[model samples]
Target: MSRSLKFALLITLRGFSWYIRHVTKSFLGRGQVPVIDSDAHVVETERTWEFIDGNDIRFKPVLASARSEPNNYRWLVDDKLRRRAMLSDIDHLRPVDRNTQTPEDAREMSDIQSRLNHMDQLGIDVQVLHNTLFIEQVADRIEVDVAVCKAWNRWLADIWSKGNGRFRWSCVLPLTSINDALDQMRFAKDNGAVAVCMRPIESTRTLPDIYFYPIYEEAERLNMAIAVHIANGNSAVCDVLRSPYDPGASFGMFRAMTAVSCHSYMVSELPQKFPLLRWGFIEASAQWGPWVAHEARRRYEASGKVFPDNPFAEFRVYVTCQNDDDLDYIVGYVGEDNLLIGTDYGHFDPSSEIDAISILKSRTDLSTSLINKIVDFNPRNFYAI
Candidate 1:
């Protein structure tokens, strides 16, 4: 055979080999896959209590007041069914026990042992840990906000650093004040935090506006991605009243769907304002991506005169979808590059451990390279981890 014919044959053979390996691993389960869980939560400990203000009048009496009145946030949701749904269904899946476990034990279980066991079972190589209910569950508190955030970040840094490299942490910031948030971001970055974690809620006038450009500018300066996660906060209660019959079901379905569009709007505007800051919406399902992306494009195109800049330019938004979503439709519209596979795993359901890997392999269109990106590389790239 001539040299050119030999080269062509070699290229064809290489492509064939790539396809075979990819298929065998995905379908036949013949190859080892490195999984990366982009989203997971670690329960806080007494160390997390370090964030609480020992001196503040509101928090100083909380422990004693709890003994008398039990001022837990769970009590604020008055409706019994809604409260049960929030505590039983939602909290069950993502348990936050500030008692029971010591700081050392919490570290060993969540950061070290649980991750290792999960990786062994699910084939995950890394897990990114975010704050538990401290940020999301207790958002209504006005006094302990800054203190709780500081303590959370401190504990998070310690836990993440203890993991060596297997575990990564997204820093928690108090959006109650923009200057405080900026200071915390700098402190977090200096102390080895990869990303900042924020709840996806609108800001009030008393609090810093979400449009505070300085936070985005500082995040961009630090080369960090902001992880926006929506939880069953006070918003869940409002959702419950809106749909009384099956409140939990209605709220659960709509929160993730609504969060995508809300974040897309933020992504559209923030990027144009700062041009360098990247954002990722974590724990939100992938099903809404195509529609949200289409709407984003549509709205921008319709109001061309008012919005001259590309709405999605500064927004390198990565949607960390549930493992079981319609991967084909998601990958098709959003493209493989933008999707990250996040398993809100290791909570109550053991099935999450197994299903995480199965979900990735089930996607026929995903090549081994693309799978790798979704599993680990995408998160690392987005969060600078």
Candidate 2:
């Protein structure tokens, strides 16, 4: 066949296959492609800290309600306010239903079956839960950090036991202490965790800093991907960058920091150093990727370094894209294998597209093979599921 005829035939075959699958799923309810919700979240409750043991019990985060902000509940950790417990139910703009609209049991994973049923309704096969609390700085004190992370991991492990392999999670580590972080990573790997969650801007150290070398090494050794979620660990930077008028920092600054981390990691030789390790820039839309790659190349040349033509592929790096992102444009930079998609399930943010799977499937602009990779193949391989 001629090249043009071959391409036309490929498109026709894919369209026919999609039509068959759609009809079967609509009528028989069994032909839909199983989807992995790669960026789901679980709301941390008072019970999330119940696993804290021994003297560490003193460091258990206390849930407190703000009198000034009656709608906000937060965690007081090491005498400092941690991230808000949850988005306010009465917030006018975002609204409570954005995140907590799900049944309380399902939102908190207190009832595993409830969450599973909710996922079933959404057509999600598995949900890789990320931490809502640890997305920001937890505590300045290493002891407190260790206590909360350990408890959180233990709590997730228990939840995973009840989830029947439908729930996977990324483990949080005490970045202040490398030895302790390694210990926690080992435990998490054994207990159904497929990745280690780290903030993109972790305090004074960035992802390429020597401080994270041990983490990258251990993550590679354990076959766990380093999940650089859209978060800032430095409260000072967040305060300075987040404007008074801005409703939230996550929408703007945190995502920029994550893109910066992606650029830094790609420009630097970190990925090459930890070749076996997979790096995922989660919840940061893949829109900035090509820009970062273009900028990374400029920086590489400025420093007399040769940039890889496809850094995302050359390095084992992946990025989670939003439904609104220019998929055709981003796919050109990231290639099909390095691009993944998620619902940002459980959070009401700009990245949250509760129907991301269906949304991607509906985009006829993208080839069916590419859509399958974003919704299934890429995420499964990235998370090592």
lDDT agreement with native, every candidate: 0.55, 0.81
Query: What's the CA RMSD of model 1 in angstroms?
Result: 9.8
Candidate 1: tens digits of C-alpha lDDT, residues 1-385 = 7542353344346434533543224534655544567776665433445545456424421222234534332322112211211121233343242211122333334346655654556566667777555333444454455665676677677666666456667887666566788888988888767677765543322112455567767877787777776543345544554565763553453355346545454435555565555567766666777677666666766877353232222255677766557777777666666678655553332113335655576667668887876875566566655
Best by lDDT: 2
Residue pairs that clash (backbone atoms under 3 angstroms), model 2? none
True-vs-predicted CA distance for residue 325, candidate 2, Å: 0.8
| Model 2 Cα lDDT, one tens digit per residue, 260-369 | 88888887778668767778999988999899989988988899888888888777789998777887898888899888887877677778767787777888888888
Worst 10 residues of 2 by lDDT: 19-28
